[model samples]
Target chain A: MKKLINKPEDFVRESLAGMAVAHRDLIKVNYEPTFVYRADAPLQGKVAIISGGGSGHEPMHSGFVGQGMLDAACPGEVFTSPTPDQMLAAAQQVDGGAGILYIIKNYSGDLMNFEMAVELAHLEGIRAVNILVDDDVAVKDSLYTQGRRGVGTTVLAEKICGAAADQGYDLHQLADLCRRVNQNGRSMGMALSSCTVPAKGTPTFALANDEIELGIGIHGEPGRNRISLKSGDEITELLAQTIINDTEYRRTVREWSEVKEKWVDLELLNKPLQKGDRLLAFVNSMGGTPIAELYLVYRKLAEICELEGLQIVRNLIGPYITSLDMQGCSITLLKLDDEMLRLWDAPVKTPSLRWGV
Target chain B: MKKLINKPEDFVRESLAGMAVAHRDLIKVNYEPTFVYRADAPLQGKVAIISGGGSGHEPMHSGFVGQGMLDAACPGEVFTSPTPDQMLAAAQQVDGGAGILYIIKNYSGDLMNFEMAVELAHLEGIRAVNILVDDDVAVKDSLYTQGRRGVGTTVLAEKICGAAADQGYDLHQLADLCRRVNQNGRSMGMALSSCTVPAKGTPTFALANDEIELGIGIHGEPGRNRISLKSGDEITELLAQTIINDTEYRRTVREWSEVKEKWVDLELLNKPLQKGDRLLAFVNSMGGTPIAELYLVYRKLAEICELEGLQIVRNLIGPYITSLDMQGCSITLLKLDDEMLRLWDAPVKTPSLRWGV
Candidate 1:
């Protein structure tokens, strides 16, 4: 594979090293049990926020760590979940006197590992809880997820929850806020081409010149369908329509109960979007797609939203979340409430997603 | 070629439409003679900064239009220079009582077209000046440029000079600062693969699976050499070394003279870089390269700069300027004076390259 990397094994470590140096003013890196934390972490009474997943989806958990976003981010190997030790260490490093909240994407490996980390943190006398995000509307279950895959909404959750944490939301309040965001947000992705992992040395999947995989997962997992390549506008309509017309999805999630002092399965459901709802539209590049193309996707998406009577109050476009070098894009629509909109506009000074500072 | 686009002819216009809708809060688009301008244009007496070029190097001229940056931007067809009418229209719309400063990259088509636009503006009694940027150390001449090709340093020049204009620099003073920035900056790029222009429907240039072109131009023009694939670290060393060790370069550039009422050629020379110089290091992706890989480039680049005794006080790492979907990267180092550094830290809220606001 033609990639700018030294060795497949050292890819994650070296990339993190580079990020640490480039953004030293905002974050610091911890090796061995790798995790990235804020430079001035452990604020006396603020609730600490943390998140993690595979390494390939950059600027996600790791790049979001800074002044008003994540207190710490645990980065696993490319497309692999971080081990419990790494997550636990990150929690220990960033936890203040108040509490800690772990923003977990709904992947099997991620759910299992972060659950273990929560238990480990409790054993060390730390109050830690997780808010699971399952906003992907493509498939009910996929290769690495038991339910809907957490996709673009994970980025929205990080920003909103981070701002809420800085706004003095306690651990429980922040967890509820995160869950509300996931319930209101939905996403669907497609891949024009597959990405090659540094270690794999080849594409994770393949497609003919005139074909694409619709509703593809971040890790190149099979989507709902593989079809012939279509125009940018057509593809955007398909993705946005799916998200807009999605039915109420019910799922069982595991959340920590402070009173019970243990995990409990809680049933939750998403509220179907309706006309006149305001949205925070997000158009994301899988990786290899250019920013100009993302604008094309955004252009079509805005039109679809206007037709559906969905008011787009805010929008974000670019490679905020991505799958290595895949050439594709994803559409995410988050129905925003007043509090969510306020927090979304709050100052955030992360390596990625910097504004209002 | 696989790309996310509509008809190739509508690519630039549609992309600009998307940008206008997405960043309506910050910028507005003018059709026919297409140009993007600040939402609050003609900002009283502030000298308006204007830039334009061929499309596809996104977030360059267009995305950089907003508060504390370009007051207006004119976008042309992909890899094709914008017409003088478009530039003149842009200047007319955003020209305050003070004057207009056109930031021109060193390309034959761009220079020629913008010079014509300046003459047209003079006929209309608009005070306009031009600042030329030719910071690439790659070669003395290329397909599109008579002398050195302007590359990554163009982004730095926009940010520094844009901030200066906001800080009350007159048109002539801002033009001088831009020239100083161009003289002290140098860049070099390499490509692992070629990008397909929408209009062309094929790769602009080609490279074998295991080969790369070093010092490649932003338009896929021929570079210094074609060689077998090398490790990312080795590639970084080659590019950074060339930029650091570049000798003094002397060239004559064209500028508009208010007194002469016409364009005049002026000889200019760049000073050789010295040890202990403080730099604002910029590592930019052509397009398709992932953020993780860019960090790898930045990692090696930082090491080399330290070894060369250069101090990096600030850095920008991402796809600020880009080819359509070229899989490669470029590195730029700009020696910073106290004024330039302070202005660099000033607030900018563009669609891309936003910070401190």
Candidate 2:
């Protein structure tokens, strides 16, 4: 309600305008289609990587567009999926001779839109592939999603897949690599407080002072259940244990097949994490959590990982992915192979995440 | 207060511990007389730069410790100045043979503790100097402060002067560079809400739903006055014009004189900002605000600068300096010369600020 935006309707458009001006050196905005692409677009022969979703999770799709990362990003209204036109335009704008890859998180709206965009791109003679990401361990079974929701691992996938694409991975290889990342990644989130949408001007949900929602989703949805507020270490332990002890989860999800040229409902399974598994532990804020607090969460997460015989080879702690103005955190564990590690370390020059560039 | 801390008393220490583990390769934390130093400390023959203050404004002193930034950072309790022992030990640990320079913000407790630490370091045969930063145009006249409070300018001073020290500037030269940065910068902040200190367990201040504090300090202190919530552009105009139209502000501030071997109260004056001034504009979040909102602030800031005939040659938009869980923003304008611009662009590899490294 106390947001610094002009109007609820103009929020997304204004944010895009501001982003275009702020990071003009790194990215360019196509306002008609509402997508952000690399400043130096159409890389001639490099595979184009595009991802997008609701606008509230900033620095995700838009901020990640630049050298060695996402080539383009389509943004929708807060908590709303982008139209197929926006995604299709973004793909066409950034695609080179190497083809295009769409990294779609397993949200019903995003999946349908990206799938439609892929079909439209096919008609345009652009080879487009989508690797569905369903890494969230929270939503056991709900109409909100087919199985688990895609949460924090989408960030890791974009970074790794972006690097691989930058290194000349073909479209099929890039899609396979993205699928591998999703299979190895798992995420769980909790909300200390709910966020108010600009239009609503009130919190999506409410809780008592001493209570919190443990398994909350990013869009201000109710979690598994409300619980008493606990200490940092206790909360960290709960999240880590849930993710670490998760059994092999099998679900029927949709993936785009280039040969079949249609969306196919395929059964996918997440392999249970094993002892001595190496990982990149990511602690993301749901917008309102501080870095200091995230580090505290990381401290407990590291302890739990060590006790479970898991090796945290790399770590990212910050508000990388978030729900608008929500006070909470999510823990993501991306099981890493040597190639994934190398790709992660590769140069990335996005607005939010940057290193070795 | 709803916070993600283990225990109120252990907040700073635990965050420091987490920072140590999170950025082990970039920084090292020393306990007892707590302070964070470069992992590879004592870069011999280099003038060591040290900055310390309350802990909530993270990534300012601690997160800025690496190859091209602060050599050491001392952290106090949340919103409380660090102890003399911490600063003293930090000065001793990172004092290369060239000397040690303390970047002290103009808060009474911080200035006093840092002054005592400088004297202590001097007794131990370390060449030490202190530069006071008081660029906040808010708090025009308060019994607590002489002229103004030091707010966002501290980040710019540490970064620009840190690069100068890395390039082998002597103690006196580095101190002078820091002083120049402080004199040329002006900042103003506004708070949409107040923050709760961990130990306090309550917000330091309060505001109505339709009200905003125009010039709130980082530690949750009142500013110029409270006003009805305004649009982003209107608020930006007020802050930008206040800083831009500020006339010569003269006050007696203390500085450590290596030659005199004493703290001296010297008259300092900030010249009125005028047309044709090239500035490095910084838009900082008050912790809870997201990158998207910060960009909105930056957008208005840029338009105002252009309208005022000032040029923003470089800009930084993020929550570099912060007040914990407070939703608001601050804008800093540091007039840049060629040398200052060169130093500003220098590579810094700290946990937060990193570019061209």
Candidate 3:
């Protein structure tokens, strides 16, 4: 693949420098023996939010750092987590008297690095809270594996929590809200083609042009299954069904517990939803899916939602989170209550995701 | 070429429905009859900004509407501009007492459609100002044809203009600023591979894996020239040099006129740039370029900028505006003055683009 880079190892550092240069007022890069954050940050009282992962997700962690989303984002090497020290610097730079919230995606490396950063922050007398986002429904949970992988849900969590923090929600409230959003949201992705990592200089995995891997991860991780290319409607149905099955299963288990209690006050939990209960559906491109294709997925999703008697109150259909250039997409559904809906309606401004207040 | 769509025609309607359902609080779809704006627009006296174009550029126009960016966005059929009627309705719906600014990309179809909408708005007694974004430097200006086609520059235009509007810049100033940003900025694009428009379900053009087309339009239009794929550094050098050359050429011509009149204000023409004159550089993914590869491009760009004595104040490197899934990127540089930098520093809240308050 033809690329416009110098030494592959210098890509991230040089790119961050250029980003600092281009957005000097909004961002500054700390280039020394290690990458750290500059001193100037946004509102001081507001609890700072920090998130990072592999550098390949450009707008994910970095693009989101600004007034309303993240206070700082530490990007590691391409598709690799930042070192613990980097996260510690990010935490120190953004941490105010209030505190800092670490929004860690459920990748093993990211989790470990962020966890270590939290420890470092504690050592520095900074109060740091960790919120792990594990919203992907593609993976099965077992004692043996690392639970479901966090995918598109991280964006939603960051935006929602960012708004909460902006609204002066306490650190506990912000952490709780982040956890709730992650719990309520579910995502599943598919890949039509393998994305070539820059260093690898080739496709991460080989797939015939006609074949697709369902439930793929952002790092080109193998999905649960492989299948022939399906129609847009079929693809939506396949993904929606998987998500619905997972979510419904969880709901059913929760409801069964309520039923066993036989408490009359459980009416709110047991009350059947009316036609207008809100839902936020995100039809996200996994890098290579076109807007046209994404909208097609939205169309099928609408049909499925209508048939299933689910009221989709809010829908975002685009490439919010991506998987390099994997050529497929994921569907994320966030069931919303009145409060969550209001938060979703609140205005936000960030580099990549924006809406409401 | 298996797709998830039922039929090509149903894509837009279905997607709109899904969007309304997913983001009910933020957006609504007047499906079947027309593409109308949601009644829940946030600002009251703010002049509504409406923009749209072909649907393949997923988040370009529609994904931008909310909070600080756009009031309404009309989505056209794949790779085709929306009709005047759709834009007119969007204009009317977003018009909050104040006039409306139509941020139109400089495509023949988009320009014509938006122009018709402006006339329609005038007929309806609605004040409408049109700002044409013609920042692409690839297309040579000639009396025989329309000027350069708008490419990635539209994103920055919408953003800066959006911030201006959000901060209560009058409609005239907003429109003027939009034009100023467009005038000050230039973008040139290249594509390593032609993207597959979902409706077409085939690559727009075929090229060997090692080949690239320079000056490619966002909608899979033929580029100014094609070239063999080279190293990332070479590609960055080619693109950055083109942009720098254009800027320098314009500077020289202006200087020549000043010298001839003996009214040469070198300070005004060649403003003494400080060590930290803010510059915003965007290494935009045409569509399919991976974030890793995009960063590689940014790295080389930083090196070149340092060599050229340009202080990049800020940088955005990602797929902000895209060309479906074309595997390439474009670079945009906006030299920022003190006032411009302050405006850039001002906080903004939008759906797709966000920065300082």
Candidate 4:
């Protein structure tokens, strides 16, 4: 395990500390119950957006904290979920008078902890709600998720919702916009190699020299199947086709109804992508893969998108969300509407993502 | 070696093809001679800035091509410097009415080829000059360089010089500004593991599980020493201290003399960094190192800078310059004056580096 780190246990805090200092102009870090918040947080009358997850997937939840993205991000230990207290503290720190919204990935740990956080926030008289993201079409049930593990779409959802929030959307409007983005997005990932967790001092999993794990999850979770290695074009087509051909996905999620003022379980379904839909295509490196290779994947992916009659109006290619130092990539395709496209193009200033001021 | 590539030979072209498509709004990829130029090239009166090197160091030359950075970038095969023709073609394609400046790294092939390209460009009736970067303090001479090799400082120079050109700095002025930046900067790198080039299916160099190569070159060239792997802080201190304590370096480099209408060798010297100097500290990943790990390194780097009485005015941490998928990082510190700081803060809209706009 040749990682540039100190003690494994200190990895998360130290990295966060470094981030806080480096981006001190943009973000502020709070330790103990570790969470990162926008340096100029708590914009009055603006809904605060918060998200949390495991530590290994960097620049995801924490690096996204800043203007036009996330208000705060709670980080757990490596590949471990943050406790509800951390989320609660983040919400408290960043919540403006408008309200709070938690963008929770649909993993068991994240779901449960964020739900608890919502309840705790409500108990403290804060109007808080939850919007779940489960855009990974590669699995129905995985090691850490019940329906689908939230993958690449979480990044899209954050960007779109962050823009909406910046544009003065209320809590309910932000929730609906986030839900719409999640429903319209699909992702599939494949692993060229497994990532080593610093504490473990070994790779989470292994593959032969000439093999790959298709449809893999972010935390090295087993995907649909392991297969022999193939060309870049072949692998890209496989992942893209799986996402494009997915019929529909239905899942029951808990949501906070302001009218009812209580948590309610609602069954939601995502319609399959159709021809002529415009997309915001994202090709993300899984840590160890180079940006040059992501461009290769993007080349083939753009070809596939064209052949499938999907117009890729916007695209993002790089290591926005990564799994430690794993060598792989994930593709996220989000069907875009006029409003979504406008928000996606809006200004965002985060540590990991920035454009248009 | 598990990489997301098709044919080994097609790796560079395909990746560029992907980059061209993914960032078509920002850049255009030309084939055969193989150079990436800004979509809005020939800025009419602004001096065009061109750079090139091996293909593996992505987002260096090509990805930096956009509105406020590089005007064009020529890429060679993996770990190989570009030819004179590629550079000449790029100069012809992007040369504005003002002139052209080629930001060449201090590698033998790059220096030789770019020198030849300048002659060819002059023969074609286009005014062109060169600015050489040799900021790497790792070794006096290495596998591919005659003096200090250009490492992380190349990125800083391109950005600063690109902004200077955007603000209408003429050819000679841009050359002097670039020389000032290169002279004021220093860098050192370390590698945790080796990266595999596509054609060369084996690792560039091997490192024991419990060892690390300090002062490593971008192309996995042998460094000053290999020792037992240490904690991230210790390693960061080693790299930072080496750069901080480097003595004045003297080298003779070739530069075009517009007045003399010839290329001439000039001996240059760079003084060591002093206390109370303002710096733009850049911590870059060598492809595979995670951004999280870089923050850990940054934490220690920041501490060392304070102890040495240097003030960091700005910072950039990510994989801006890479060596394929090698797990390592490099640190670059550029002393900034009022003009350089202003230009450094200017809007830059590239595929990899974007800020202020």
Clashes within 3 Å, all models in order: 0, 0, 42, 0
| Candidate 2 vs 3: which has more TM-score | 2
Off by over 4 Å in 4: A141-145, B141-145
lDDT of 3: 0.71
The window of 10 residues in a row where model 1 chain A has the poorest summed lDDT is A136-145
What is the Cα root-mean-square deviation between model 4 and the actual structure? Answer: 1.4
lDDT of 1 at B300: 96
Worst 10 residues of 4 chain A by lDDT: A138-147
Which digits, one per residue and each the tens of the lDDT, describe model 2 over residues A8-106?
A: 888888877877877889999998879999999999889999999988888787989998889999999999999999998998899997889999888
Q: What DockQ was computed for model 1? A: 0.87
Can you write out model 3's per-residue Cα lDDT over A1-357, one digit (the tens) per residue? 555556668777866765555455556667542442423674678898888888766667776766567788888888998888887787767777688888888878887787777777777887777777777778865335666777888887877787788789978788768777877788898888887676788889998877889989989999999988776778889888887766331211101111232212111111223355467888888766666567768877888877777777776766667766678889988778777777776766554555442
Note the Cα lDDT for every prediction shown. Answer: 0.92, 0.88, 0.71, 0.92
Q: Against the true two-chain complex, what DockQ does each candidate achieve?
A: 0.87, 0.73, 0.34, 0.91
- Estimate, for each residue in B156-203, the C-alpha lDDT of model 3 and write its tens digit: 777677667777887777866876677677788888888776678788
Model 2: how far residue A338 lies from native, Å: 0.3
Candidate 4 residue-wise lDDT, B1-357, digit = tens: 889999999999999999988888899999989999999997899999999999899988899999789999999999899999999899889988788999988888888999999999999999999989999898864334489988898999999999999998989899999999999999999999998989989998989999999989999999999999999999999999999999888888889999999989888898999999999999999999999999999999999999999999999999988999999999999999999999999999999999988
